[model samples]
Target: VDGEAKVGWPTPSKKLELYSKTMADWGWPEYAAPAFIRSHIHWEDLDLAAGERVLVPTFRIPTLIHTRSANAKWLNEISHHHPLWIHPEDCEKLGIETNGLVRINTGIGHFVIHAWRTEGIRPGVVAASHHMGRWRLGDDKGRSWGAGKAEIDRDAEGRWHLSRGEQQPYESADPDTGRIWWRDTGVHQNLTFPVQPDPISGMHCWLQKVRVEAAHPGDNYGDVMVDTDKSHQLYKEWLAMTRPGPGPENLRRPLWFARPVKPLATAYVYESGGTTG
Candidate 1:
């Protein structure tokens, strides 16, 4: 029996390897070493004078799942509004008062929402929980638990606009729908966000760099404006940052890596004249 301690990790070195040889052998050599890779919204990339702030959209309320469980009236009542969690300092700097309208301008569009100035959030950074702010175009009471009635329109400039109204009590199969007291269903902020996938990991980056300011005179409480064309352009830009597959061994991806729905071994191989499944 070996006398040495067997408490080491299961890694190749039997200990934490700061320099990952596995990554270097793979397509991502740049990530082989622990390094701080700058994000798309790096601090240096933002213009502080322009009211630019990083939007942390991945925050979630402990009482709610990610936009789910809306049918639970109790949960909806507790975590109803997904307001912009801004620092009081930033609010004062931007002239945004508590519960005041703030327009968050993303690359593709902007969403008008109420601002909650609290020290719980970091300065120069803002957050909006993922729960709530659901909307439906018509009177589809199917998801009426936390969803509000919204009017969607496209302008001549090919920009999409969604204006959500306050949630009103309505007659539904659930008797509780009629007794609904909370009218603030929150604003749909996702519509104004653009898809920013990480190049190396292929994960969606939820932190968005945006301009935060007081709402314009015409901006409504739940107003959302998106330019589909601009969104497409930004998508293409981020797509170009990624490295195409066919990594080591001519495989679409590392065979050891886990996939949601694993296909056949043949499907993982790169076929020059074939399209993705």
Candidate 2:
């Protein structure tokens, strides 16, 4: 039955279309066909130094949700630490041990985490899971299953620092709290990354070209430092890359593109010579 039948896609022409009419009509003919566009952390654009490596920070562990499984005791016990996954070759070249501490420097800040050498990751690239790293300003606040206590402060230069405190066994209504076996809640590396949205997709790009070096003096396992001022500047830089909308017929967005929730047809049309609210 399968050999006798033929099937095609749902779009017009009933086949895969490399050229997109929607993109051409929306004033983006250059992107009508599939093509590679250089990104903020593109390898050629990064020109990484000896110690610098591209960090793929948005990868997720199969067992956990995106930063939401911290409240689950079983999941926390299964995977507690979100260690920096470095390729074995790169780790050896940089003289990094399996459990050695490494500081990853981003555009606006740096995060200190433990390096775990593994062949599962690609050479010259490092990865860290988005799970874990849940923290509360004080020990009394937040859930105890996967969150740790941290002290945050701002210096004279407007730099924010988050220093993690030890997670000690505490007496609570839940007896499991007293049997806590792990001290590390991982490092909150996302706080150090700046917003870098893709121009066309508008999705935040999570990959970053960062310098990975031995942890500096006084650097703790979960240390995270950021400069909000610089982060804001980066936000503007990416925002500037976007092309103005109000395409043909003064439509705010391409009518063919799917949105989370479809709005009224009138909402798609912007006022003459004015942007939509």
TM values, all candidates? 0.90, 0.88
Q: What lDDT tens digits, residue by residue, belong to model 2 across residues 160-212?
A: 99999866678889898889888877888999999988877678888898988
Candidate 1 on 91-177: residue-level lDDT in tens?
988999999999999999999999999999989899988787888877764557788888999999999999988888888777888
TM-score of 2: 0.88
Q: Which number leads on lDDT?
A: 1
Query: What C-alpha lDDT do the candidate models reach, one value each?
Result: 0.85, 0.84
Candidate 1: which stretches are off by over 4 Å? Answer: 1-16, 259-264, 273-277
**Model 1 residue pairs with clashes:** none
In candidate 2, which residue ranges exceed 4 Å CA deviation?
A: 1-15, 271-277
Error of 2 at 31 (Å): 0.9
